[model samples]
Target: MSYVALYRTYRPKYFKDVFGQKVIVQTLQNALLHEKFAHAYIFSGPRGTGKTSIAKIVAKALNCEKAPTAEPCGECAVCLGIDKSSVSDVIEIDAASNNGVDEIRDLRDKVKYAPSVGKYKVYIIDEVHMLTQAAFNALLKTLEEPPKYVVFILATTEVHKVPATILSRCQRFDFKNIDTADIEANIKKIVNKERLKISNEAINAIAITSEGGMRDALSLLDQVVSFTKDEISEEDVYKVSGGLSRRFISELLQTIYQKQPQKALDFLNQVLQDGKDISRMVSDIILALRDVLLDKIREDKKYPELNGLTPPLIYAYLDILNELQQSLKYTTSKRAYLELAIIKMMNHQSIEYVELNQKIDALQKEMHNLETRLRSEVQVKQVESSKNIKVQSKSNLKPLVTVSEISEILNQGDREKKNLLKIGWPSLADYEVPQLRGVAKLLHEGSLEAVGANRMLLVYDDIITAQNMLKKETKEKVLKIINSKKQLIDDYTVLLKADWMILKDDYAYQYNAGISKPKLKEIDLHLYEQDEDSIQEVKLEEDPLVEFAKASFGENLVKVEE
Candidate 1:
């Protein structure tokens, strides 16, 4: 009983003493110094952010016999009475208990009368927003025109809910939540002031747990002080508050970074087995990752907790968490989330999360730069293909084009298909072709040879690929799309022809370092590398065929028999 709560004991007695609302406090101080106090005042902000505290300070300042000033002399008789809650004229009404229209009417009647003892009759209504609409209506007239001796000080957490009619008649002052640094410093001040021995880490835990609320921070400190004798340790602080453990989160993220899903899963299992809720773990991972993101972003702050790791490392850890969050919806398991997150973390090229972010960002910017260049190159290729299409319209009277020309027309397709399937396939599906045209993923590659009108010998390679593409679901999809029956040509097709062998791997052809990639790049570069050296220098010829004839002469070599 001897020890009062830190927030309560440390509650500001004067305007200058109120924390984190300098603007409001200064304005109040100026008002008091000028003897320009408002009839009714509203103080609003988040809880534990000094709304009510400031209101009480204002009440004491106006009524304090020491003279109206921002820094009220706390030793004054009026200030002492307000502090002791024994002031007769200064009524502190809990609107929560007295929220009816009758209460407002009764209060309204009383406001018309003069203060019994003091110069001003101050009404400090906490949670003033709880007043019924009827109560507010009854209070509005009294709020708009109170006697010189009466002052109304309303405090609420929800200023948004307060009626405009009530707000218009009163002076509004808003309070702000304390910052993390301020909270930490205040805790340190208290520890030093009280001669209590607590670790810096414990002080930090209290600060972080407070989350920018001074009252909450004080409460945490109070609990820690009560739990253990005078000296509170960091471990005790953490146990008292089940906040997300940063060490555990970092370790889980490291496993994710390793991409060892099995190991990551095992680690996740341990967390779950530790009696931690998956949702809580997932939420903590997100917050810790958020802190990681903050650490990455607030590079200028040089936060002590974010020391050692660079911005890039923080970002890499953040990126891992971001990836984990993406896959969270697929499975509700905490283990799964942790595993996926850690696995992603493992894949990061940079071991440091901050390094990964910067590198990732740099690489992303570079990739974007590359993409812009690639798109410009592609657009140039597309324009060239468009020109060639017009050119081919005149000189080429042929229905079926050559393999290289087939490659040329494919430039107009979406970048994905062009990059994925490549113009390896001949014609559009259901396109009227010479039967050889539709079989390009095969025919041009020597999988099919023309024998007669509609018959062709399906070669072994084409047979294999077609077999894979025509698998159960694929066959269903193909049958739905093409409306075709397989004409088994070779012994290979007859023996092993169930599904079409569409290569799952886009670079599977390039899997052989020596063979596959070079050929693919050769083709990609060959087809894509068509444009005037200086696009601005090009003169438009009447016949588009002239440009193509020149380009063909350059590299494309349109394979026109003319």
Candidate 2:
């Protein structure tokens, strides 16, 4: 009299009718035929993989009046009763709601009674992982040593949460996620049987979005069918599901790759305006990038847009987008954050080089903290000592900048001498490659000093920037880009501005060169917390004891220990 959902209407009544999980079905069928079925069985896998449906089919087959048959006789009273969920002997328990020691104890009491009409009294407990420890302990004995007429079937999406004692007592069968092709085929069979007119694209879209879940796919189809009177299309599926189109994603990425920040931002606004979730939009972007990466690696020519994109850049896109997606949950203004992240990603020189910048920033912060700690320790010692006592001056101590001695090359033959001689510094900013362009811009912050046969040295205004130049990815990208222009050097190193002043003095003293000794100031170190906008304050529940102490002690005397 009432319309049933597609998933429920098409629920498998027999093993042959179940889509996907062929191996599991065959195993159960053979076990039933050979009379080798286990007293207790465990079916575990991802949701919508037909764990419960398979359990019901097995129950019907075992309890059929036909007796020990591989296939149940649907006309028989026992089979009909099980199918209608009216059978007294075949019980289906929702462990998610009924999981308790008392409930399990009640089940144990009922298990001793013989079947009313069939050979076996079946107990199918779904979501068995929800059972508490005590409930599991109660079920363990029954599962391990049940009556001859009893069979226990436990199903869970998460098998790990099931107790080991309960697991050890059952014969386990792991259900795999249904393949997309199998899901598509299953949908097609449903469409034809139901006389529903659906486009191939709609079917494919449903299959892809279901993500290997048959019930989910059917549910989506049912929703689409209810929305559209006839002739379902891909657009209808996307509209109903709030999914993005590949064309729009491809266009957005193209705009970003071309460094059109405003255009990309506008497009992002359009997507959000259309009621798409910001987090879901980021996920779609990441998925598109993943497809491009796979296409590039496999050289499949599936995504022509990814033809020239480098793997490092693709990886960088994934990393930044993933971080953006994670940060969205903490903010109320999702649109603003999404816009800023998109603009940064588009304008950033190389996705890979961002890693180097983050590393440098972290290291610089750590170095400053270390310096502050040392300074505080020195000040404390000075205070402890007599006020008239003189402390040693750190001003005269030279900055710690070390380099390999060059005497060996200087004393070598003409070839070595020529190889070690300085050459004119080339500008890296003019490189064409995006990866190269980014590295070159960062490298431009320092002054190039000398170029040897295989190595070069440069000086930077700060120690941290110089250290960043030495990062493996940054260094490799710099060398690759520079070498592409001219094979001048293969490796390079950096020196701080203060240290460069000392090096200039050495060169002037040793070679009688016109280089002058430049005076340098020690860097000022100050500590500050990271940007307030980026820091998310998490609400942690207070411990009951701490709360009680604070309430009783007027909050002032309460000291919370870490």
Candidate 3:
């Protein structure tokens, strides 16, 4: 004789009583009518979407005294017993608490017995995703091949957690969120049937808050109904649910649209002072802005307050409010964030100002690109002119010291051995110690090819990596690390590995073996003797005529007897 909750009191006993799941209901009934019912069923979907409810309904339909009928006779003892949870054959287990291997083994043992009362025994396990791996594994064999008269129904909010093996053996049904219109219609029916006086606005508010869950809609309606004896207004729903009213949302948006920043802030402060939730206020504002956007798109003047505002401006308002809604989760000063969000929304520049700024930015970027192109063209012209002049002046200019002369000087003087430059060549690559290993990796492509007191030549396989070393910061770091213990060298000349190879071959051929063989200096030839495999062979067939002309013209053209 106690009052029953609305959700339980009005629970769907027949398939026709359920809403928003016509496909599932039709499919289950067709399977039942043809005697093609699956032995194992898995119901998976979001919480409170009638997954468990549908499973129970299927149980009632299967074991009805009418025998394999799609509709259960609620008057029968078997149907009543299942509805009241008193049936021995129709068992409902909460998997959250009983999810263990031992519990599953006990279940497997009990599944073999025939139904004591009904023709079929049904087991409904809720939250089956909570079952441990061992429990699932133990239940797999029995689920795949249960007794002929036994049926297993598994329900879970997360289907991904269930093993594929169990899923393969069961017929899966996906429950969808109840549509808002469906929820609204269903609530209206309950209101009418209960003979309660509730406004349309209050019913809409409950539907929106339910978020596609029918049970939630009923519970919220029940809560609102309990507090009021007379007609339930929108204010009662907002007050009970800690939500904001449309008037508050409308006034706040009006101040923002009119660009009255201080007035907007004051209004928000007043809402907080009256105990309105910050998050709820933001959500309500978002919904109002969405309606404004819809009206803007439709070109309908449903909301007179949004008549003057453009679509972009309304969208900007929505973006700010939504962003603040997210940022409030991490902050303690919700009121402060909300106020700042309103001021930002109000202070946003008019459409004309925003477009003008965008135009200016685009023009500046174009001008910068033009300047860069002109500067690069000027540098290219300068380089070409310099190269032409060098070609014309090559007959007049002569090296102050030739390679032969340098070789003599290097071989004759004991300074070649005593110079710290020679000793530093071997350790330069290794100098990129662990601390500077990143720079060292870049340097490894090149080695210390030639060393002198004033300068040294380093070769790198990749030109880009070599150029990276030529950067001012990179040059400083390399020199600092190299001379950290002792400053043996002052400056460096970074060269491509190919260029270094050419220079070495030319020096060796002119002074040691190829074109002009000069008298040998007892230099430490060991320092320059390259591995035969490392030396690249040059064939006359591969040379272009210009290179042949240079080689034939002698190292210098017009050899004059002075």
Q: lDDT tens digits, residues 486-510, model 1?
A: 4322111111111112221222454
lDDT (Cα atoms) of all candidates against the true structure: 0.62, 0.75, 0.74
Error of 3 at 351 (Å): 7.4
What's the CA error at residue 122 for candidate 1, in Å? 1.2
lDDT of 2 by residue, 124-162 (tens): 999999999999998888889999989999999999999
lDDT of 3: 0.74
Model 3 C-alpha lDDT per residue in residues 204-301, reported as the tens digit of each score: 88888887888988998899999898899888888788787777777877887677888888887776777888898888888777787777667654
User: Which stretches of model 3 miss by more than 4 angstroms?
Assistant: 297-304, 348-562
Clashes of each: 32, 0, 1
Worst 10 residues of 1 by lDDT: 491-500
Candidate 2: where is the Cα deviation over 4 Å? Answer: 297-302, 305-308, 352-562
The true-versus-predicted C-alpha distance at residue 461 of model 3, in Å, is: 65
Q: For each candidate, what TM-score against the reference?
A: 0.56, 0.61, 0.60
For model 3 the TM-score comes to: 0.60
RMSD to true structure for each model, in Å: 18.0, 23.8, 20.1
The best candidate in terms of lDDT? 2
Write the candidate numbers in order of decreasing lDDT: 2, 3, 1
